[model samples]
Target: MSFITLFITASMPILKVLLISALGSFLALDSVDILGDIARKHLNKVVFFVFNPALVASNLAKTITYETFLTLWFMPVNVFITFLIGSILGWILTKITKPPKHLKGLVIGACSAGNIGKMPIIIVPAMCKEEGSPFGAVDVCQSYGLAYASLSMALGAILMWSYVYNIIRISSRDVVVEICASPSEGFDDTFKNSSKQPLLPSADYTSITTVNQSSFSSRMQQWLTTSIDKLNLKAILAPSTIGAIVGFVIGMISPFRKFLIGNSAPLHVVEDSAYLVGEAAIPTVTLILGANLLSGLKGSQIQYKIVIGIATIRYILLPLVGIFIVRGVVRAGLQLDPLLQFVLLLQYAVPPAMNIGTMTQLFGRGQSEYSVIMLWTYGLAAVALTLWSTMFLWLVAS
Candidate 1:
């Protein structure tokens, strides 16, 4: 596809979703929280555990290939880069705006949040599910899942650790252990682990708006205590490590591959549900965003410049970078399928995860401002994602 067409394809999906959502809102069918509530109660659950896990498992079940191996490392590399960039940008953003130092972390956290879990789930299927995607594209998740899983391990751990360490001022070891123990950390516990619950009935999206100093302080204290109480690396890694090692070992044995994959094995389940739930991940994320909007955020927190910069990075810079990387990978003899390329492209296209706001809150950064960033990015995400998907499809088609 020509550059113009590529952009058009990318932009259309988001536009369609937003246009429809706007229509829905105008019709007064539901409030923001109402949508969020529906997402949490219905979509979030089915996707997170059932869909995401199946997706991850299916990707992991395939035989290891050189291309898939390399794709595995890309995400952590991106996360590390994003972290450095976000920190530097945070420093710069804080210097120019001069919000209280106490609040500075929020901006970094917000800008730095990557769509770790959702990106792969949503992206892998979209681009690869079709014929002539990057690889045979049948196994596009091989690329997306590994990258997602690798980064899921890398960044999820880092984000959780950063939250515990900076916010609680805890020992590094303790943070690692806590993250490993908590299934939310990606690997260690990962999405496949039954240790944690992805969608909780107790959740209250409205509470996201309670972002004042007092609330921040309260959260910090809670984080510190949790970190202190939960540190246990051996125990934490035991379940997931065992599951991963045994599954991979059995898969490589060949005789077990088909039988195991078709059966009730965790890996098979991961793939089955990941494709299904992955579809819902973005919408669920959008609802999360909508919930915050309904919570009544303020203007001062939503700086226009920051919002523009973030949107530019998310919609523009990230995908452009992915394009270059994809071309480089293909030229450089990586042999990645086209669908995988699309999924990788998608990994970049997603909005920052909710963790950005949480990290800001936990660490005493620009909690207010970051929360606002999350709000706008996600507000735009529902439509933005659809628009991007359409653009991607057209790009490949052309």
Candidate 2:
């Protein structure tokens, strides 16, 4: 396919997202008042628990098999590298700009987790339909494309909920602690004052020894309790994560998959039902994204530089890194399908996941700032994705 044709094909899906997002934004306006904060929240809850999981499970059950899984092994690795590199960049940004403690997670998350799920699912199939597409027959291209997309969506959800969720949760807690702490009770003051205090006058040697032992035991018990509480696996195992897990099981296990997945299966209705519900996930998410942007536009104190920095990392630095990584993977003798390689490359270039906004809303921190960040990244995605995809197609085709 020519670069111009590829760019046109790639931009279609993004344009669809933008148009739906605009509708959402318009509906959220006070005059329209169709998708207000309360409405958006309720919709978000449904999407989070029901629509998202259903979409992920239904798609994966249909697409992934053991053979395809092996062929696409690099996908998970590619996603991990995006997260790792984005994180390193996020950390550097935090150090340089020193955003509020609570926003640290949001920043890192926005940097790390690209919109891996919907974009490729939408873009690749559209490209496959184009006359200039390099990938073979439409049905074959779409089938494989959906498989790659579904896998990316599933894995991305797991990583987002597990890794990004914890980071935001911890950072939010730290911010809360900071906000709640009184000046005199601050950590620095507590530590400095405690260190300067003279040692307790020696009591009877035996009494002192006993007291020290008791204190040590109490501290150890407290530490153990705190550690256990902090390692709350339930918090990390979010609905999306759970969905991904179930999807993987269904996809990888033959008997189970056969029973639930295909048209001929007795229980195919179960998959179909889930898929029907899951089909709503993309439009709902895009709408919520628009509604959230409305809020960001009204009033957001987020630094423009922070937003720019994140955009640069996600759109500029990461895509360049992805090109190298995909090339290296090919060089290392891994035979990835062209469409899959394009998906992998495009993954790096796409905007941050909408789930980050959901996370901030869940935590009640950085929602406006997050919205602002998302607004910019997604706004830029049309141009960014088109150009990068044009280049990626050219590179892969060569």
Candidate 3:
């Protein structure tokens, strides 16, 4: 396909996202009052707790197997690399822009995490269905594309909760002053107590030596508990993670796959039901995403530098880096599906994860700032995704 054809193919999915999101934005309007804050919140809960899990489990169960599973090993590594590189760029951005202390985490996070899951669920299959698509048959491409997207969503959740969650938390903790209204009073109290505590608590040298001489096993146990507590394992193993685990179990085991996967299976109804619920995930998430972004238009003023810097990091620089990374990996001898490679590249080019708003809401700060940043980044994403996707399709096809 020509570049123009590829660009059109790529734009269709993004345009659909924009259109659906626009409807969501419209519905969230004051006069419309349909998908308002409370409604979006309830709907988001459904997506996170129910729709997302079912979508992940069903898609993964149908497509993932020992062979495909092994082939996808590099995806997580690629995601981690995006976070690592984005963090580095974000740090540089912080140093240059010197945004407010409270807003620093928002900047880093906006730079670091992309909307890996939701965008792919919409984009990849839509591209596959296009007549000019280079990936084989439409149905096969979509099936595997969804499977790839589900895994991406699950992995993104784990990393977002564990990694990006902490960055925002620590940043929120730094700016917290007086007791204020927040989602968790207990969490704020912990932050307040830690803030008050001295960096090096005064202690007797004898007590220190005695503590150092304590049994290794007891110290190890204490260290393990602290590590787990800091990591927030509960969030790490989120509903989506659980769903992915269930899917992996079903996919990897031949007997389970036979019983639950195929149309002729004795237990196919269960799989069918899960898929039915899962089908709601994509459109619902896109709508919620649009509704949430409505706040960006009405929020407080933010530094244009921060927004522009993060946008450049996410849309321009990251995609270029991703192209090199994917091509290098191929050169190093790992054969990846054309579609898999496309999604990997797509991960780099997407806008920031929407969960940043949730973090700000939980912490009771920077809500306006996050909104302004999101408005611009996502507004620019339509163009960025189209250009990069066009290049990616042409490269993969050639």
Best by TM-score: 3
**lDDT tens readout by residue for model 2, 1-398:** 66677777666666777789899999999999999988987998898789878877777777777877788778889989989999999899899889988988889988888889867766777788777778989878876776677678777877887789889888887433236777667978889989998887666678989989999999999999987666556655656667767877898899999899889998999999998998788788778877877776655898899999999999899999999999888989989878989999988998899888777887889888887887788788878887888888888888
lDDT per residue, candidate 1, 1-398, as tens digits?
45554545455445444544454333323533444445444654564344444434444555433444455555455556554554555457656766544555555544455665544444444444434332444554445444345335334444534442253222111233233354455565454676665664545545555546569899999998887655534332432233344435444566666555555654566445544543444455444444444332554555577677677667666656656665566679865454544555565567766544444444454555665676677676766676666555554444
Please write out the lDDT profile of model 3 over residues 30-131, one tens digit for every residue: 999999988988998999899999989999999999988999999999989988999889989999999888788888988998889888998988898888
C-alpha lDDT (0 to 100) for residue 119 of candidate 1? 46
Off by over 4 Å in 1: 2-51, 62-67, 128-256, 263-289, 296-302, 312-335, 359-368, 379-398
Give lDDT for model 1: 0.51
In candidate 2, which residue ranges exceed 4 Å CA deviation?
Answer: 173-232
State how far residue 33 of model 1 sits from its true place (Å).
6.4
Q: What would you estimate as the lDDT of candidate 2?
A: 0.83
Which 10-residue window of candidate 2 scores lowest in summed lDDT? 174-183
Each candidate structure's TM-score, on Cα atoms with residue i matched to residue i, is: 0.57, 0.83, 0.89
Considering summed lDDT, which 10 consecutive residues are worst modelled in model 3? 174-183
| CA RMSD per model (angstroms) | 16.7, 5.2, 7.6
User: Of models 1 and 2, which has the larger lDDT?
Assistant: 2
